[model samples]
Target: MIERGEDWVPPLPTGERVAGAKRRSGEGAAPTHPAKRKAGATERARELRLDETKAEYRLWGELRGRHLNDYKFVRQVPLGPFFADFLCREKSLIVEIDGSQHAESLTDESRTTWLNSHGYSVLRFWNHEVLAERRAVLDTILAVLEGQIHSPSPGLRFAPATLSPVGRGGGASHG
Candidate 1:
């Protein structure tokens, strides 16, 4: 039955199918095609999530695709089910911006741990540091890439003070 919402036009011949018909719907009826999964496709998906943060945006402009100093870095990096602010595949590094809200979330800790387990180093910068001390933050990232600052150890220590009170133990706070 041709419903009001369904396509009224006739279907294409079996052999005259469109190249993107199956891709747009994310259905894999046929054998997997390597060309459909390019090496940079993951990076491209991450790039779609960029937002306009004054500091983050500016940094992005400077370091987009590692344009700055020719050091390759991808913005809005997708890892697993989450997205990182920035990622360098070559160095297996991720840079994140942590706001006051982030200080209280166990989710960040879990995310960091997951990334670490996958051999990717995670560096988190406070929002204030990103805004007020942008250069220092960038410098720190560069230094890490330059092999000056050793990556965090396998067992990273999370300071209790940074965790949300409830995250530490108590129930969720109303405020």
Candidate 2:
């Protein structure tokens, strides 16, 4: 028989202390993720849900419960080291609502590229566009989901919030 030293620490089990182990789908309930996530990721997603922006709140109202063209959407879902603002698992799409601070951010560019390579299409809309031109935003989301707008690459298909909400100008246009 082998004996362990007093100073040795036991390995942790992934199935334990993780929120998904208990129940499913709610404020604190964690969805099963393919990528390994830090415990803080689950907590942060919950916190973001609790402290949603006005833009996020308004968008969620329309997207929740398969309301957008009968497509189901989940908010604050963990995607690797980041959290998607809104995600439709079925269509592999993510929607981001941004303010002026995110205008022309290279960080967002890289993030989009990474997410796209992982098979998720990302669409971003400015806060004002979401609040003032909500119907347009919803329509755009539906277009992408229905394949009216095709993204060859997520990063190239998006324009920064600095540009048109319709994203007319990008490195590459959706066909």
Candidate 3:
């Protein structure tokens, strides 16, 4: 072992070093408290809003400024541990725009489960669908917000097939 001078100092832990680097680089440092985490999440949500995908931008155009049924929609909202694409606090609704990567994703399924358990109804739309069939997607969201679409009970698993806009016989169905 090498002897150290009286002014010698030990190296910082790995986590601290990384955090220090982030701070020095002007990147936001990791939050250290619950409140700080919440604030960080808010900032992250803001960043996501600014860097939204094309599909997200299109949807926001329709949803923002209370353009959809006079309902206010916020984009890139941070919920428990997830960032919702859009959220209507009044209706307890969350809208998620999924890309191809989300198909049959177990993580998405679990996320939907958690949101449902927390009394939030989640609506998922394919990115392509949002871009190509904007009207239909808006219609589906409107129907749900208007209570025209019946969602499954809290404990019951929600089936995407049940709420499909296509083949609806003028009435919503729950599965």
Winner on TM-score (1 vs 3): 3
Whose lDDT is greatest here?
2
Residue by residue across 100-128, what tens digits does model 1's lDDT show? 77766545554554445445677877777
Off by over 4 Å in 2: 1-34, 152-175
Off by over 4 Å in 3: 1-39, 152-175
Q: Could you give the candidate ranking by lDDT, starting with the highest?
A: 2, 3, 1
Candidate 1 at 35: error in angstroms?
15
Question: Candidate 2, residues 1-175: lDDT per residue as tens digits?
Answer: 5753311222223223322222122334322332445467788789989999999999999999899878989999876546889987766778988878787554565556445545567788889999999999999889888888874544344422222223221233233
Q: Which runs of model 1 end up more than 4 angstroms from their true locations?
A: 1-50, 65-67, 151-175
C-alpha TM-score for every candidate: 0.58, 0.68, 0.65
Model 3 weakest 10-residue run by lDDT: 161-170
If both were scored by lDDT, which would come out higher, candidate 1 or candidate 3?
Answer: 3
